[model samples]
Target: MGSNFFHHPNGWVGTTPWWKDAVFYQVYPASFKDSNGDGWGDIPGLISKIDYLHQLGVDVVWLSPMFESPQKDMGYDISDYQAVYARYGTLEDVDQLIEACHSRGMKLILDLVVNHTSDEHPWFKESRSSKTNPKRDWYIWKPPRYDSDGNRMPPTNWRGYFAGSTWTWDEQTQEYYLNLYGPFQPDLNWENAECRAAIYEVAMRFWLDRGIDGFRIDTVNKYSKRTDFPDAPVTCPGVPDQPAPEMWCNGPRIHEFIHEMQAQVLAPYKAVSVGELSNTPLPKQVLPYVSAAARELDMVFEFSMIRLGTGNLFHGKYMYTPFPLSVLKRHVATWQTFIEGTDGWHTVFCENHDNGRAVSRFGDDSTPELWEASAKTIALWQATLTGTLFLYQGQEIGMRNMPASWGVEEYKDVESLGFYNEAVESGDEKRVQAILHGLRILARDHSRVPFQWDDSPNAGFTGEGVTPWMRVHDQYRELNAANQLGDPESVLGFYRKALGLRKEHRDIFVHGAFKLLAPQDESLFMYVKESGEQVGLGADGNRKKALVVMNFTSRVQRCPAISGALGCRKGDERLLVSTLRSGLARGRVEELRPWEGRVYLNFQP
Candidate 1:
């Protein structure tokens, strides 16, 4: 009956909790909807869309940062932790959004941006005023390095996240401040006890007191920076300019800080925290942050899958190559297997506000016909995974990447603008084309487009003649939610149907076992999800069992390990959901086309 045990693969009991089964729909408040005729989406607009999410089979709404910010990084640069952004309405509007979610029997979690704070934030302002100030220790600060010649230099050879040195020189204090992100966003000093305590209060007495469920902590692993401030090794081969990921991530004090925060606040409120762990490459590195025994966080989202496109962090978004299926299988299977017996859980996601569209990244979205099929295929893959499903806004209708024709005017993300200038400075037209093309495929601005509610002008996100913060995707006229609401073949309709399976067979989809099938094959991606021997959580006495096969390529491919994965012949399984047309037969796949995904139920060994 304890929450720390679950049904292990060896036919014994293991612990799985309610958080393991939660399905989160991640929404960017600036792009979700606009109730008023204002150009920007607001809390009231999100409140107006409760029924839409409820119908999409959502269990929780993980709204992105709405906390008071200067909009430098689109709210990641929080100016005030306790207050809502003026553009997003008041705290009452947030309460209304929360109440609406609760009324629809859904949970809501705010985005916690505690890793860093905006330079405009009062804490940062005071901390930057004087070196000896009491609050000066609240942020990472160190004297600049001086050589024998008295030449000033950064404290370390560290660069983080975006383009620039990690250390920001402050004129007022005559000291260099550490920032793993934008210059305006200074990294917090977790080493300070008062800083940690104050953050705990913000999470507990300030936000949690308002009756919200939990937080999705952004840049969680960056909480503790390597203390020595030494020169970092290069993260990727041939990318000597970029500092190693270890230089500023997964440092010594991460677990200690997380556990202390949990003990002081999270446990008391019984609320959950899912941390966004960037640059952590291994499961062991990931385990401590989310292990139930550690009592740190409920879960952590490791960026292994999403990084497949660029291969590594240093490669950045400029390297646009088709994600090799071979590498994707290895990364996924390794993490899935390592976390199987542990209390740590995985945060399953294909796309989010920080990345490109799922249908475009992993699916074939070059044309209209391929877009719908590939989108549904990805949706099916997302829902059937064995962890908390995080569905980004517009993911249901298969939103594609931004158009290649759009220039810097259409782009809002700082990364895109930075990369654009860097490319132009190279004096190569081909390089410029490549950089822009890559942005269309990988920039965060692509996902920040206004959500398409209908086929009306402005896509029903805002009224006529109002300019949104970012441009809407051009395809919204044909692929809007209104068009897909009833059509069974539409991408939205497909998601609704596939999500129903999670309710019908919770054990298999939620707290089930995940095993990668045909890990060596480079074309078709296959896997199996099965429940433990005991009767799963539902009223039925049967345990969960299913086989999922997907073709990542445009070419037809057979199920390479049909017998090995399911322990049964092809005819023995029943097809429940498929992105393509028709039933499968024989050992070889029956007409498995490009970008096709299929799930089999009633499958037994």
Candidate 2:
């Protein structure tokens, strides 16, 4: 169902959907935990941790792909939509997982990778069998082009997400098939009604029927591509195949296909749909997909917040550059204000399976002294925002980037490996070093390390003497969950308390009106959230208000006075939480320590 709005005593108040205030926890299956000593995390391992997740106050669990695949793109290249990957577990294990999550009042959502299928998939195999096969149109295939010297070339000069050309020639069929991602994963032809029907039956209905609460759609905006097969304009200099997001992303029929999926599967089951709308930056462009009136998706993940410091070169996002904190503040304010009172909703997240650790990327993770404080600061920043908050695995315990000493050989992510291979082939040592530095700061594999359960071997991710599929972070001995379980000042403890506060004051933190304070401050991020009487709720004349102030740098900064905005005098506000645990219960915070954050509840005059 869509958002419902009604008139209250003070004004109009919008009633949020169930997911609006929910806390989502995303688990990268292979890296979360391992059972059976197989060195790979599975459904059983997840089932065993249900109590821990519930204790962490998570409302929904979003799992990355666990479907049958060739493990080409980390289970993204699905070979069978209806079957579970053997390494992850069987169909029965998934059923048990559903039961376990539902028993605790938590919902489970799977990552839906429908943009492409593994080349080894039976349908793709049949389609490539011959030129006139009945299933030939199941995937996008076009005739090859030739140069003046009779050198055969692919259909278009569009680069794949992993690298190289988007088109891969099929020797048997004598045609080039389009694969926006890896060559082993062929894109489906959404224009074909039969193909669309098949995808809905297996990918959507199959999972929804199996009791999955909803889906986190992968590459949702890249389904429909320009059919004319035009060469991409040279955007990055010296690159033969240019990135053509403009032609593929948000194509003409993208909405139509999403609406169809909504009607056929999601709406019927009343399932939550959070689309990964990559390359769609503007809030206006994302509005149509998530607006209540559209009947498409419930929300979407926007990349603008995460791409803050990257550039426009060929190594985009893999190149690191320092950006002013004001730019990040402006982007957050813009999105928050744009959707403040609209039917559209947004997803608030900084860390996921795709990005570097939040603490390392955004917070000061330079020393042991700053780790917990900075992680708690990031947590407070996310908790106060107006959207569905997502916490990736290991974020609660302050997991960080892989150690700088490790080389490219330690990286297991396809993107990181591809970038390294390409960089080294150029024989430019300085350029390679620069790219490696960026990888150390921004590689996706940084987030894929095994979960640190305790100081035990392999971070307790796998049994002793069993090497995990990926290496555990080196700091696990000091940063595992067990070490922080009892310490109230630990990042895990702070997250539980912060999430509990958000739940306790759902109206104020979830549906409250947001106002940015000290917007131009380079070293501080401060905002106010007011609900209840101010937002047309609390007919009994009760008003709820909260003020959040954060120091974004390693140096102390004076917190700008927010007492005026909260309508409370200095020292009259109740201190709810602070990163430092300074033991001050109620007072005006005049100064904030390095990487410090504090929240307060305002007193009514």
User: Per-prediction TM-score, please?
Assistant: 0.92, 0.95
What's the CA error at residue 527 for candidate 1, in Å?
1.7
Which residue runs of candidate 1 sit more than 4 Å off their true CA positions?
1-16, 147-149, 234-241, 426-431, 535-544, 559-565, 569-571, 581-589, 603-605
lDDT tens readout by residue for model 1, 25-116: 99999998987777888999998889999988898999899988889889999998888888888999988988999888788998888889
Worst 10 residues of 2 by lDDT: 533-542
In candidate 2, what are the lDDT values of residues 1-605, reduced to their tens digit?
63445454435355657888789999999998898899999999999999999999998999999999999889999999999999999999999999999999999999998888999999999999987888899999999999999999988888887778889987777889999888999999889899899988989888889899999999999998998878888877787788888879999999999999999989989899999998887888999999989999999999888876565534555768877888888888877776766888877888999888888888978898788779999999988887789999999888999999997889998888777778788788876887788889888899999999999999899999998899888888998999998887789999999899887666667667788887788898888887745542234343667989899989878877766667666676787878886563524457788888988887432
User: In candidate 2, which residue ranges exceed 4 Å CA deviation?
Assistant: 2-15, 532-543, 582-588
Clashing pairs in 1: 5-14, 5-15, 6-13, 6-14, 6-15, 7-14
Deviation in angstroms for 573 in model 1?
2.3
> Residue 97, candidate 2: how far off, in angstroms?
0.4
Deviation of model 1 at 127, angstroms: 1.2
